[model samples]
Target chain A: MLSEFRNPISFARRSTANRRTVALIAGLVATLALAGCHKKVKAAPPPPPPAPSAPAPTASITATPDTITVGQSTVLSWHTTDATSASIEGLGPVPTSGTRTVSPTESTDFNLTATGDGGTANATAHVTVNTAPAAPMAESNLTEQQFEENVKPVFFDFDSYSIRPDAQSVVAQDASFLNQHPNVNVVIGGYCDDRGSIEYNLALGENRANAAKQALVNAGVSPNRLRTVSYGKEKQFCTEENESCWQQNRRAQFTMDQ
Target chain B: MMNGKKQPLYLLLLVCFLLLVITPALRAQDWVHTGTNLGVQHIRVAVASFKPLNNNAQTLPLKSIFDQTLFNDLKNAGIFDMVSPSMIPPEMPGSPSEIHLNLWSAAPANAAMVVFGNIAANNGQITVQGFLFDAKNPTTPQILGKQYSDLANDEATRMIAHRFADEIISRLGGGINGICETHIYFVSNRTGHKEIWVMDYDGQDAHQITHLGDVALSPRVSPDNTRIAFSALGRDGWAIRMYSLTLHRLVYFRAPVGNSFSPAWTSDGTKLAFSASGPSGNNEIYTIGANGGDLHRITAFRGPDVSPVWNPKTNSQIAWVSGRTGLPQIYIMNSDGSGIQRMTDGGYAVSPSWSPSGQFLAFAWNRHYGPGVLGGQDIYVMDIASKRWIEVTHGAGNNDFPSWSPDTRHIVFQRDNQIWTMLSDGTDQQQLTHIGQNIMPNWSWK
Candidate 1:
C-alpha cells in the first residue's frame, strides 16, 4: 500500500508535465458531446396535431310560391346550407339535378331540392294553370345568347353568296323562338359597319335580314313572324374607333312588328 | 496534435451531414399551376370528329376541316398540353358518345383535361355537341356550355367550330370574357373607296371606327382594347393615326418625313411599334408614344422591316417580318433593334403574330408541299421553343394575315374577302362574316 501511494504521487507529477495532452483530449470530447446534443435538439421539434374533422355541406331548396297562376312557373331555387355533397333527382333524369330546365308537362308539381353541407332545404313548385296565354302583345326584347342565335343571320359577306357560321346561330335561334311564340312578329333590320359604301352596306344589310327571315321559315317559323329591313353601317354601338365599333354597327336587330 | 486531428475530423463530418440534410428541400417540384398538386406540364389534344354531308355530291366535301379549326383554337389558347391529331384514336364513323370520364382517364391524357365533340348536319342545318372532361375529377364531365346555331348550306362547318372552341375557353373561366369578344378593323373598299370599320370579335354589330375615307389599312388594337392605331392613305400621303374606342376621339402621330404603315402596339398601350420610311430612305422599325409624343426609331436597317409585333409580357423583344434575309422571313430582335435572330427559314413568311405566351408565332406562307392550289398561300404556326411548325390552313383558298386572340387560343385572319378564325394548331378554320367584303381581323385583349 505504501508503494502504491508513492507511485500515484509520481504519476501525478507526470500528468502535470503532460497537461497539454489532457487539455486537448478534454476539448475534443467536449466538442463531440456538444455536437451530439445539438443534433438531438434539432430532431425534437414534433409535427403539428391533425386538423379537426369537418362535416360536409348540406343542400336545400326554396320557392317564392307553392302555387303559381296558370302558364307561370313558381320560380323555386334550391339552396344547400351545410351538406358537403348534394344532388337533385327526378326533374329530367337522375343526373339533371341542380340544373335549370323547363318542365315539359303543364300541371305537375315540381319536387326539387338541393342536399349538401350539413343540412337540406326543399321547395315545391306549383305551375299555374292557363290556356296557352294568348300571345302577349308583341315585345322585341332579346337576351344576350338570343342575340348570337337569332340576329346575326341577315348580313351577307362581301361579293359572295356565302354566310358565315358565327352569324348562323343567331338566325337559327331567332327563327326557332319566333316559331315558338306565334303572336310575336319581328322585323330583321340589317345594318353595316362604316367599312363599306353606304349603298353597298345597305344591299348587304338587306341580304342579311332576308337571310334571317329565310332561316326562320326553314326552322318552321311562320312568315308572319318576321320581316326584313336594312340599315347598312349607319348606326353604331361602338362608333369610336376601329373594329370595336364597326362590329357592333354591323348587326341585324329585331323589332316588334306592330 | 492527435486531439487536434480528431476535432478537425469531427468538424468536417458535421459539415458534411448538414449539407446532406439541406439539399432535398431545396430541389422540389415548385412549378405548379397553383391550386392543384397534379401539375400538367404537357397536354395532347386530338379530335375524332363527324364529317360533313355533301348535299351536292358534285363537289367533294372536306370532312376534316371543322376538326382542324377547333384544334387550332384550343392550341392557340396556350392552356393545354396539345397532342397532334395523328396521335388521336380513330374517329367514330357516325355520332359520338357523350364524353365519358372513363375514356379520358383510360387515354391518360397528358393533360388532366380533354375536349371531345361531334358535328352533324341535315337539310342545310347544322348541330354541334361538345364536352370538356376534367381528368382530375373523373366523376363529373362538364357539358361545355354551348349555343346551337342554324347555318345555311353555304356556311362552312369550320367557322362554327371556332365559336365552339371559344366557348370551351369561356367555360374554363377565360377567352370569351367581355373584353375578349372578337373585333375586326379593316380598310373596306365598299363605299366606292376604302374606309375603316370596326366590329365585334365575331364580326357582328359592325360600326365605323374611322370616318376618314382615305384607304385606311393595317389597324392595330391597343393592349387594353380601348384604342386603335391605323395608317390611312390620306390626301398628303399615308398617315399614322390613333383613335380611342372608349372616348370616341382621334389623335394623329407626327408623320415621319415620308410614310408610316403597319402599326403595332406595345403591351403597356403606351407605345406603338411601326414602320416609318423617312429621310433614312429605308422602311425601319420605330416607336412612338400612345398619346402621340416621343418618337424613337428602333431599327436602323437598309431593308424593309415592317409589321412589328411586340410581346405583351416581356416587351423587350419585337418579332416582325423582315426582308433583311433577302427574302421575307420572321425575325426577333430586341425592342431596341439589337441581337436580331432570324426565326424562319421557309419562303415568304409574313404577318407574324406573337402569341401571348411568346412561345409560338402564327404567320402566312405559300407552301409547295402537298395538294390543292399549288403555290397558293395559307397560314402556319411554329412553336418557338420546340421549333415545330404546324400548317394551319390547307387547300385552295388563300388564308393570310392571322392575328392571335388576346387569350392566345384563337387566330383570326382573312381567307378570300371574308374574315375567319381558327385554333393555333392549324385546326378549325371558320368564317365569321357574310355580307360585304371584310378583312384584317384584329382581336382584342381583356
Candidate 2:
C-alpha cells in the first residue's frame, strides 16, 4: 500500500514537472521502495573495545656546564617520566630523577637510560674537558748533577736511621724542590759508615732511605715521585775513620732517576 | 803324667809374662785429654824444625814449608803451650838414635812432649818421617811414628805436615779431629764484584769460586762440600742461588717469590733454611729441599727474620735472627716451626752460627746498641743451655759474621773488611785476607 501511494504521488509530480523533475521523482520512489523492503531496523553492534596500553617512558639529562678544565667537576641533572628505573653510564644506578656532581679526569659523555613496563628511553649529555697545561720546561730542564746539588744529602747519627733535626730541614727543602720540579723523579740512596755488620748495615741503610722518603711524603711530595735504595757500606763518600768522614758517609743521598 | 804337669806350668808362666808386657803398652797409649773449655791446662810442647834429609833444591823449600806449617798448626791448636824455637837445642834429631831426650826434658825446652820430623825430596817425590815422643819418659819415649809419601810440592808437603800435626793433636788434645784439612768459604769483592771465594784453613791458596758478575753474599757450603747455597741479586730481585762446586756451574734452584737471603743448610745436606719475603712481603724463615721442592714456611710472625743456622749436631733445631721484638735478636725454634725461644735478651744481635757440638751459638752483637754507644759491634758466643755469653771480639773494628770451624775450637769472622780467625775463647786472632774486602766467611763442614 505504501508503494502504491508513493507511485501515485510520483505520477502526479511527474505530470506537472519537466524530464529532470520526473527523473528525480523516479529516484525518490526507488529509495522509498528499498526502504519499505526492510520490515524492522536494529542498531549495529559497537566496534570491539580498544586494547589497554601503558604510557611510554621519557628521559632527559643536562650538565650545568658542559665544558670544564682538567681536575674540575660538573653537576648533572636529569628527569624521567613514567620510569621505574634509571641509570647513567659511569655513575651507575640512580633515582628516576635527580642530580649528581661528577669529576671526570677526561672528556666524557654521560648517558642516562630510563626503563619501565612500557619501554626504555635514552638520553646523553656530553662534557668537554681541557687538560691542564704542561709543567714549565725551565723547571724540568735540570741536569742530574744540578738536581743533586740543589737537593743536598741528609745525614743521620751513628747506628741510627732517625732523621736528625738538621736533616729534617734539608728533607723539607728537598721536598719543596721536588714539588716545584714536578717532572723530576728521584732515587734516594741510603749509606752508612764503615762500622757494623754488612747485613745489618744494609738493613739500617734501607731504614734511612725509607725514613727520608717518608719525610718527603710528609712534606707534601708525591710518594710516586721518590724511590729508595740501600748502598749500605758498599759505596762510601769518605774512607777516613774519623767522625767527620763518617758523618759524610752516613747520609741519604738523592739522585735524579733517568 | 810328669810331661803333662810340666806343660801346664809352662803355659801359666807364659800367660803371666804376656800380661806383664801388654799392661805397660796399654798404659802408654793413654793420653791426657784436654779441650777448649775453661780451666784446661795446656800441655807444654816443643817442635824442632824438620831436618832436610837430602840437599835437593825442593828439599829445603818443602822442609821449610812443612816445618812452618807444623809449628803453626800446633800453636793454633789452643791445647798446647808451644816452646819458642830459639829455646830448643840446636841438635835436630832425624832419627831415634840421634836425639838426646834429656836435653828436651831439661832447661828452657822444659817440654812434656816433642815433635820432630825429617823430609827428603827425590826425583819429584817427597817422603816424610814424623815422630812424637813423651819427653818425660826417657826409656820408652816414642808415642807416635808416621811416614808420609807424596809428590814434591809445597801443598803436598804442607798436607803431610798437617796430618802429622793432627795426629799429635788428637793424642794430646782429646780425640777431636783437626780442621787443618778444611776450607773457609767467603765473599770477596777483589774481582770488582762480590764473588764467593775459598781458601785453605791456614789462609793459603785463596781462589775465587763463583764468577757471577752480580753481587753475591753469605756463601754457605753444603755439608757434603759439593754445592754452595748463597744469596745473589738477579733480574728478578734477590733470590737464593745454588752453585755446584762439583759440577762447576750454577745449578737449578726454584726461585721463590720475593727477596731471599742467607741460605743455611741442614746437617744432612738435604734442606736449606733461608729468609725470604713471601707473598706477605715480610721476611720469614722458610725451608726447601736441597734439590728444590717442598717449600715450607717456618716463621709466621711480623718483622724481618733472617740469618738462619741449624744446630748441626741434631739438625732438628734452628737458630736465627728476628727483629720481631724491635731490633734484631737471636732466636731459636724447632725445624717444624714450634717452640720458639728468644736466645738474646736485648741489644742488636744477628748472624748466629751454631757450633758443631751444638752447645754454643756464635753471633755478632752490639750490646750497648744505640746512638753514641761507647762499645762497637763485637762477636759473642753464648752457651745455649746456660744462656751465659762471652764477648769473643771486643772493640775490634766492627767484627761480624762469626762462623765456627768444623772442630768447634775456632771461629772465622770478618773484621774491618778483612777475613780473620780466632780460637773459640777469643785467643789467636789472625787476619786471613789482606788484599780486598772479604766478608761473610763460612767454614766447610769437614
Candidate 3:
C-alpha cells in the first residue's frame, strides 16, 4: 500500500542515488573480500609449522639400591642423556654423578627425574633396607668355642700381620679367660697370608704370635700360662686369593694348650 | 896309638859323606805318610796330573796364602808320604794313567797312590773331577770322587786342587774326614751391615742368611746341627733369637726390656743360658727353658756379666766371660750360679767358649802391655783344670770371639769383620773368608 502511494518521479531519483550507493558498497565489499582471501592464503603457508624443536629433554635420571643394611650404605643417583637433574624431592641436586644416601627408611621403590629440555626422564630405585649382620657371639668352655668366640671375633686387615685395634678386646678377653682359670693354658697361634717366603712368613707369624701374647700379658694374664707359636703360611682358613677369603686367613687365633 | 887316632878321623869323615848322600832322598820326601800295610813296607803316593779346566787362565789372589793353607791341611793329616812333583824325573810319565808301573815299582815308591783331577769351568760353577790310582798298577786307577762347586769367577782354581789333595788324604785313611763338604758360618758386613752368611770351607758359595742388615753377632750352633742362636735387633729390640736350621724360623724368647743376649744352648737342647740386663740395667746371667719357661737368675751381680758358654758334657758348670773385676775376664761357675771362680788372670779377657771335649777353654785377651799402643786382642786356649792360658794367635789384627769347632781341634774367630781359624796352639793361622768380612763361625755338628 505505501509503495502504490509513492510518485513516479521520486521513485526514479531515489533509484539513481540507490544505484550509485550500491556500486560504492559493491567496491568496498570486493576490497574487503580480497583482504579476507589474502589472510586465508597466508594462514595456509604457516600450517607446515617451525618443527617440534624445543630442545630435547635430557635424561639425567639414575637408579640405586633403595635400602641399605644398617652397617652398609647404598648410593642412589639420577641419569640424564642430555641434561642433568637439578634436584630430586628437595634432597638437592647431586652436584656430581653418584649414588646418594636417603634416610634409612623402609624398603621401597623411588622415582627419580631430571627436568630439562622438552621433558623429564624418570627411573625407579629399589632399596632393600636391612639390619647389619650380627657379629659372631662369644662364649667360653667348649672345644670349638675358642675358634668361634675368640678367633671369629678378631678381624684383620687384608694381607697384614699387624693386629687391628678392634682385635685387642678379643685378645684381652681370651687372656682374662686364661688368667681366671689358672690351671688352663692357652696358646696364641699366629697365621699369615701366603705372600712371602716360608722363612719370612714364619718370622712374621712369630711376630704376630708375640704381639698377641704381649697383649694377653698386658691384660694381666701370666706370661707362663700363655705360650706363642707361629704357623706362618702353613695354615690358612681360606686359601683363595680373594678379599673375602684373605680377610678370613690373616688372623691370630687363641686355642687352649693341650 | 897314632894309627888308631888317624883311623878314627877317617871314619868320621866317611860317615859325613854318607849322610850328605842320603839327605836328598829324605828332603825330597817331606810328608810322612802312614798306611795300614800288611804285606808292603813302603806305601807310595803319586798325585795325578791334569790340564787346566778353562781358557780363563787367571791366577787367584793370595796364592802363597792359600798354598800354605793347603800344605797345612794335608801335612797335618799325616797320611801321605808326599813326594814332591819336582823330584819326579822329567822322563817319567806325567799323568797317573800314563805311569810306567815298572819304573815306579823300581823307584822308591811302592803301591803308589796317584791323584788325577780335572778343573773345568761351567758358567760360574767349577766342577773338580778327580780319580785316585795306584801308580804301581797304572791300569787300575780308582775313581775317587767328583764334586761341583759354585765359585766366584775371580777366585783361584788352586783351592780346587787342594780339595782334591784333601780327598786323596781321606782315601788313604788318614782318619780325618775331608773338609770339602764342611761349611763355615760367619757374620759378614758386606752390605754395610752385619748379616750371617754360610760358605764352603774354601770361602766359595757365599750367601747371606739374615737380610735384616743389622748387627748380628755371637752366632752359635746347636749340638744337633738343627738350630742357630744369635743376637739381632728388630722392632722388638735387642734379644737373643734362635733360627731353626730345619724349620728356618726366627724365634725370640720373651726377655726383659734391656738387652738379653749372649745365648748359649745346652747340649741337651732343652735349655738356654744367656746374659740378661733387666729394665733396671743390671746385667746378670740367667738360665731359661728353651721354650721360654722357668727363667732362673743364675748370677746376682751389679757389673756387666755376659758371654755364657755351657759345658757340653758336664752340664753342671758354665764358663762365661764376665766383667766382675772392673774389666772383662773369664769366669767359671756352677750351673746354679754358685762358687764362681775367676779363670783368667789379669788384662781384659772375654768370650770364653769351652771346647766340645770339655778339656780346654777358648777366650780372647787384650792387654796394655805395649808402651802406648794397647795390646791387640788375640785368641787364647787354656786348660780348664790347670788354668794355664796359652795364646793361640799373635799379630797386629784384632782377633776376638773364639768359637771352638765341634771337634775342638780348630778355633774360628773374628778379625776385621772376617773369619779366621788356627790350631789349638798359636800356629798355622789362615783366613777362611775373602768376601763379606765374616765373623763368629759356628761349626755344625752334622
Candidate 4:
C-alpha cells in the first residue's frame, strides 16, 4: 500500500494534504498489520465520496413573427430553467426569460444558450426574411413582381421613339395602376432593338421611355413619381437575329418601388 | 637567309591585316540592305519567351507573362503569320550576342522577323528590354531595340508588351499604331445589371470600372483617357455621369434630369458633346465644357437627333444622327451648329461616328430598313467628302455603332449583343467580348 501511494501519476493527482494523509494512514496501517511477521497483509483503503451532479439547463425560444419581409422586425421570446445566465449571439447577454426584437435585413437564425452548473443548453429560432421589393410602399394585394407584369411594356416603331397606337392602351393601364398606388414610385425604362449603335439606341430608348412617361403624366400620374431610363439596345429579350426578335426588343418598360 | 625569313613573316602579318579590314565592310554592306515583304504578304514573325535577367520572386512569373502577352499581341495584330514557338529553335536570346538568326530563319521555323527581350522585376519596379530583328537580312538584323520600365505588376508588364509590340508594328506595318494598348469600354450585365466595364483591346484584363449596381449604358472614355462618361439610371432618371479614372471615384457632371446619353469628347478634351432630351421634350444635341458649365444646345428638332461625335481631326465639326426627315440619317455640321448638311442621302442611318482622320463617318444603316429585310442593320462607312458609302459588315448579324481606331484603320462595332472589330476596309473582323451581353464598345482614342 505504501509503494502504491508513491506512484508519480497518482501522487500528482492527489492534493498535497490528501497525499500526506494518505501516506500517514498507509504507513500506520502497514506497520500495525505487519506485526505478526508471518506473512505481509495488504492495506485496503476506502474510496473517496462521489460528487453531486447538477442538472443541465433547459431553454426555449420562439419568434413572434417567424416570417418577415426585408426591413421588417420580429421578436424572439425566450425562457430558461436552471440557468445562472443566458445569452444570444447577436443580442448579447440577456435575462433568463426575455424577448429581443431584431429587424434583420436578411434571413437569420437566433441561437439562445442557457448556462448552469452542469452545462449549457441551446435553442434556435429562425426568422425567414425574404428579399423582394419589400417595404413601406408594398401592397398586400400585389407584389413588386406582379406589379411589373401588370404594367406591360409599350412597343415602338423601328428607329423611332414614338409610341405605337397599339402600345397606348398598355401605357394607360400602367398610368391607372400608378394612380391607385400614389405611394409607389415607378421608373420608366426605354429599350431599343439591336439595330443602331449603343449610343444612338440609348438616346432612342430614352426618348421612348420619356414618351411613355409623357403618356402617364397626361393620364394624371404625377411626373414627380415617375422617372425614365434608356437601356439603349444593351439588354435584349431574345438572341435571334431576326425581325421577330427586334420587335420584342423595342419597348418601354416599368419598375416600381416597394 | 634572314632577309627571306623576314619577308615570309611580313606576308603573314599582311594577310591578317587584310582580313580585319574587309570583314566589317562586307557586313555593313549586307546589313544596310532595305528589306520589305512581298505584296500584301503577312510578316512571318516569331516572339521568343523573355529571358529573365535575375532570379527573384517576381522574375519568372513576370517573364512568362510578358513573353506570352507579347506573343498574343503580335498574333492578334492580324498582319503577322506567327511562327509557333514550339517549332522555333530553343534559344532564349536576351541580346544580339546570344541570337543565332540562322536558327530563326531556317527550315520549319521560316521566321522573317524575330522579337526577343529580357525582363526583370525587382524592388517594385519592372525593367523590360525588347529588340525586333529582321532575321531575313543577314548583316544588320536589329531593327528596333527599346527599353521600358514602370511600376511592377501584371498590368505594367502587359503595358510593356503592348508598347514593345506597337514599336514593332510602327517600324514594320507602314506606321499604324498597334491596338494592343487601347482599351475597350462597354456595358455588361454580368453582375445582374448593366454596368460599365473596360478591357484590353484584345479582350484581356477585363474588370468592372463602375459599381453603380444599376443600369449604366453607352460608356465613352474621354479622349485623354482620364474619365468615362456614361448614363446611369439614378433616382432622378437617366443622367449623364462621369467617373474619374485617376481618382477612382464618380464625378458629378450636373446633367439635366432624364436628358443625357451618348457623351462624346472633343479632340482637345476641352468639351463634351451629348444628345439630351431637352425640356422634357424631343432629343437634341448639347455641348458642355469639360469642367461642367457653358452648356450649349447644338440642335433642337421635332424628331430625336442623337449620338453626336466630334470630328477628332478638326474638332470644328460634329456628326450625329438627326431624324428630321422621319428616318434617322447621318448629318455633319460645324461645331457651333453651323454648316448642317445631310451626309447620308436616305434609309435608316444612326450612330454616326466620325473617323479619327475626319475624312469619313462610320455608322449603322440599313438601306432597306423596311420589314422583312434580311439584314436588319449593318455597319456602313461613308466618306464625309464624297458621301460614297460602303458596307463594312453584311448579314452575319445586326452590326451597328462603328467606332474608329485612333489610326482610322480599324472600327469596333456592336453586333448581336457582342462587340467586334474590323479593319476600316471591311476585313479581318474579330469578335472582342463574349461573356455576358456586352454592348456599346467605345475604343480609347490612344
How big a share of the true inter-chain contacts is recovered in candidate 4? 0.48
Per-residue CA lDDT of candidate 3, range B139-209, in tens?
Answer: 65554655535473434445665566666665675345555445677777889887777775546667877
Q: Give stretches of model 2 more than 4 Å off.
A: A1-188, A209-228, A237-258, B1-41, B51-55, B87-114, B133-147, B212-215, B233-239, B254-259, B275-288, B291-306, B321-350, B365-370, B373-377, B393-398
Ranking by TM-score: 2, 4, 3, 1
- Residue-level lDDT of model 2, residues B186-295, one tens digit each, is 99999999999999898998999899897898899999999999988664346788999989998989746455778999999999998776443356789999878899
C-alpha lDDT (0 to 100) for residue A16 of candidate 3: 54
For model 4 the local lDDT of residue B316 reads 88
Q: In every candidate, how many clashes are there?
A: 98, 0, 20, 1
> Which CAPRI quality tier does the interface of model 2 achieve?
incorrect
Ranking by lDDT: 2, 4, 3, 1
* The 10-residue segment with the lowest total lDDT in model 3 chain B: B30-39
TM-score of each: 0.42, 0.69, 0.48, 0.64
Specify the highest-TM-score model's number: 2
Q: Write one digit per residue (lDDT tens) for candidate 1, span B1-446.
A: 45876998899999999888866543442222222112645354445454443443412242355565576666655555576555454444332244444454455334456666555565566666565656567555454545454563323465576667767666664434422335667656566455677765555556777777546677887877787888765433345777878878786456453456678888788888887653333456788777667887877754456778887778888988765433356888888878888887545567788888777888887533221123556777777766556676777476667888766657888887688876665555667777677776677765
Per-candidate Cα RMSD to the true structure, in Å, reads: 36.0, 29.9, 39.2, 33.6
Fraction of native contacts under 8 Å reproduced by each candidate:
0.00, 0.06, 0.00, 0.48
In the range B246-278, model 4's lDDT, one tens digit per residue, is 999997788553567778999888998988877
lDDT-wise, the better of 3 and 4 is 4
- Candidate 2's TM-score: 0.69
Clashing pairs in 2: none
Candidate 1 CAPRI level: incorrect
**Predictions in order: chain A TM-score:** 0.40, 0.55, 0.41, 0.46
